[model samples]
Structure formats: C-alpha cells, structure tokens
Target: MKLDARSAARILRDPGALRVILLHGDDTGLVRERARTAALAVAPDLDDPFRVAVLDRDAPERLEEEVFALSLTGGRRVVWVRDATDAMTAPLKHCLGQASDTLVIIEAPGLTARSRLRTLVEGHAEAAAIACYPEEGRALEASIRQMLAAEEIRIDPDALSWFAGLLGPDRAATRGEVEKLALYAGRGGQLSLDDVRACIGDAAGVSLEDAAFAATAGDRAAADTAIERALAEGTSPIAIARSLLSHLHRLRRARLAMDSGQSRTDAMRALRPPVFFKRTEAFGQALSLWTADRLMDAAEQTQSLELDCKQTGAPDLTLCRRHIARLAGTAMMLRRDR
Candidate 1:
C-alpha cells in the first residue's frame, strides 16, 4: 500500500500489520530517520544484537534467512536493510510474500514510479511504501511544532515563523536546530525572535548559510574566509558540503522557474524558507552565473566530495577545503565569462 505523509506517523506507530515497510526518498536523512523509528517500534532495544539485525544491499539473499530465523530471546525481531536498490527486488518480493513475524524495513534512495522494487512493495497486500520528502508550508510548521512540543518548549508565533524560515531541507538538520533552541530556552520558557537569532546566528560552522551565500555569489575571498573560519571553529567538512548542495539546489529551482518563463524576482520570492533580504542581490547574481545544468553538475561534484570526506583514510577537513576552493575558482571563471 502507498502511504501519504499525513498517515505515515500513524502507520509507523503500529506497523505490525505490515510485513515489509519500504522508506524511499531523495531526502536521505528523512529516510534513515523513519527507518530507525520503524525498527525501534518493533525492536525497542536497538542495541540488542539478537533482536535487531542491520544489513546492506549486497546481502539481499540473507534477508529471507534472517526473517525466518527464530529470535534467540523469543520476542519481536527486526531486519533492516540499508541503501536498498533494484538488485534486491527479487529476494524482497519472495520474502514479503511469505508469512513471517519479523519486521523487514528497507531504506532506499529515491525510486522512479516504474521501479520494480517500488512497484512490488506498493502493490503487495502485506507491504507498504512511505515516501520521505522535505516538508514545507503547513506541514513544515506542524513538524516544527511537534518537535518543539516534545521538548516542552513554546515559541512566539512570529518567532516560530522566523525560526522555521531558517530551517534547511534536511530533517536531521531541522531537528538539530529545534533541539538547540529548546536547550537554549530551558524548560517551559517561551522563545522569542531575539532568542532564535541569538542561538542560531553565526553559531560556528553549523550554520553555513553565510559561507554558502558567499560561495555561490562569486565572492571568492569572502567564501574562502568564511570556509576557513568554519573549519577553524570545528565545523565538519561534510556538513559544509551538504549546505552548499542545498543552496545550489535552491538556485537550480529558481533557474528552472525562470526557464519556464517566470521572472527571476517571482521565482526567488516563491522559494520556501524564502531568501533572506540581505542576500537577495547575491542570490540573484548566483542565478545569473549558474544555470540549471551547471548547478546540477556542481551538486554532483559536491556530493562526491562529501562521500570521500566520510572515508576513514580521507582528511575530511582538507578535502572539504579543496572542494570549496575549487567551487570558488569555478565561480570566478563563470563571472569573468559573463
């Protein structure tokens, strides 16, 4: 069965009826978060080796075996597959068709409508597919409220709107920001716009908004300086790279809208978490420099660099710096050509 975002939380709370739950989407963070939530629903003790088994896409054949195996401790069992792909479709289909008590959750990247894996899960009577996209509009506000309420924190309506506007596309990042605000406000205290700015503004490399703006706007010196400051202040290279990718994605959207005959001003105004007023001109200049196709290419390169930084043998900070420097150089060249 196909699950919409509104019904997803309710279904996740009691996923016992479903044998296989497939969480696939472009938002990797949301996919992983939902997968963990579902796993914990079945196997509360995630750390227990006997109850929870984590596998990768390579071991699709082992899925059925793991599902059929009786739990050593005699309670509910969970078998989670990470980075699932089409290659595992056959085994998953066979496994989902059989009767089993174990909860099988597959975390996959975004799948096409015609994808066999997506079709199998969505079409099967015993399975369900939950799409994990970035939340926006009313949905985004509701999520913010829910997360903040969990911490017993309250915010002024205006403050809540401002804070929500600053949130990134990644759910994990959004959670982190809310948690930071909650901690700052303390229990039962109300947050104001001032508090939001104080806690979030220039809080190290965590908020790479400034650096990202600089990089994309062809301010090579400012971008280089900001990146160096962030790294010096202990910001992870992967985090910075992700921020850059998010910014580029926004630019791509604006460019696409313009290609479709919308005015640049209108396109920028329509952006979710709307562009900050201070950086409006820089953002416009970025649109002029990076076309939709070039933005896509830059995004791919940044993602690859982030993956490399995560490798054990890699110098993450150094690799991140190199990536930013290269982008800065490209930005400069693009500007000269224009």
Candidate 2:
C-alpha cells in the first residue's frame, strides 16, 4: 500500500500490521527520521541486542537469512536496512514473500515508478511504500506547529513564517532548529519575531548563507571567513555544498528573469523568501557575475562536490573549501571581464 504524509504516522503506531515498509524519497533526513520512529516503536530500547538489527552497505549476501532468523530475546525484532538500493531487491523480495514476526524497514533514496524494488514492495499485499519528500506549503507550517506544540511552546504567526523560511528541505535540520528554539523559549513560553531572529540569526545556517552570498559575489575573504566559521561550528561539507547549490539555483532563476526583460532589482525583489534587505546588494552583485549558463555550471559542480563529500575516504571539508574558493575566483574573473 502507498502511504501519504498524513497516513505515515499510522505505521509508527502499529508497524506490525505491515510485514515490510519501504521509506524512500529525496528527503533522506525524513526517510531516516521516520525509519528511526518505526524502529523505536518496535524496539523501545534501541541498544537492545536482540530486538534491533541494523544493516548497512556491508550487509551479507543473503539478507533474507538475517531477516528470517529468530530473535535472541524472543520478541518482535526490527530488521532495518539503510541505504537500500535496487541491488538488494532480490533478498528484499524473498523476505517479503515469507511470513515472520520481524518488522523489516528499508530506507532508500527516491525511486521511480519503474524501480524494480519499489514495484515489488508496492505490489505486495503485506508491504507498504511511504514516500518522504520534503514538506512545503501548509504541510511545512503544520510540521513546524506540531514540533513546537510538542514542547508546549507557541510562536507568533509572523515568527513562524520567518522561521519556516529559514529552514531547508531537510527534516532533521528543521527539527534541530525547532528544538533549539524550544529550549530557548522553555515550556509554555511564547516565541516572538525578535526571539526567532536572535536565536537563528547566530546559527550556522546564517553563516552558511553568508558564505554562499560571499562566494557568489566574489568576495573571497568574506566567503572564506564565513565558511570557516560554519565548519568550526560542526557543519558538514555536504550541507554547505547543498546550500551553495540552492543559492546557485535561485541566482539562475533571477538571472533568467532578467533575461526575460525584468530589471535585476525587480527580479531579486520578486524572489520567494525575498532576499534579505541586508544581502540585497550582495545578491545583485552575484547576479552581475553569474549569468544563467554560468550559474547552471556552478550548480553542476556543487552537486559533484556534494557527491564527493559523501564518498568514503573523501576529504570533505577541504574539498568544500576548495570548491567555494574556485567559485569565488570565477566570480572575480567574471567581474573583471565585465
């Protein structure tokens, strides 16, 4: 069965009804979070030796054997497979056919309608396919409210909207920021626009945003400083690269608008989550150097950098810094050519 966002919560409550659950989507953080929820529901103590079995890239060839094996403690067990791909379809399909008390949860990336694994799971009567795409519009707002409500905190409408804009597509990061805000507000305390600004403004997100803006504007020194600050704060290189990709995408859109005869000022003003007033000038500078085509190229490079960061044995932080520096240099050369 296919599960929508609204119905996903049901799985956490009673996952046993479904023998196999496939959580797959572009929003990996959400996939992992939901997977964690399902696992915790089955095995309250995650560290329990017998109840939980986590399989990663190094999982054995006969994964079904692991799934069908009896639990050491004689209770329900959660057999979780992380980073599942089409390569594991055979074992997963085999496991789905046989009946067992074990709740098999597989977390995977976004799959197409033609994906063999997705087709297999979705076709099964005892299996469920849950898509964990990033929530937006009312869904995003609802999530923010639900999270805050859990901490017994209330947020001003304007503040909620502003906070929502600051969040990326990652559910884990969003939850972390909300949790930080909740800790700051305490239980039953109300959050205001000022409070949200003060708390999130100093976060690594702001620095990362600064780094993106600086790199795109060709301000190498400023970009380097912002990137260093963000890295020192424990931000992952992949996260930084993702932020740059988003910024480049926005710049590409704005540049395209300009190509369509809109003034740069007008195009920037029309951007969603409207460019912050303080960064308006920097954004304009970036537009001047990064044309639509160049922005697209930069986006591709950023994506490549993100992938490299995820690879084993990759020097993620250094590669991220080098990429940002290269972008900054390109921006400078473009500016000089103009």
Off by over 4 Å in 1: 203-338
Cα lDDT tens digits, model 1, 1-338, are 99988678987878967888999876787889899989888888999988999999889889889988889997889999999889879988787777888889999975777889999999987888999986755677788888888878888876776566446457877788788888998887788767887888866533476678878888878887888887776666766776787788889999999999999999999886577677899899889888889999999999998889768789887887777778778788899998
TM-score of each: 0.65, 0.65
Estimate every model's Cα lDDT from 0 to 1. 0.82, 0.85
Per-residue lDDT of 10 in model 2: 82
Clash count list over all predictions: 0, 0
In candidate 2 the C-alpha lDDT for residue 95 amounts to 77
lDDT of 2: 0.85
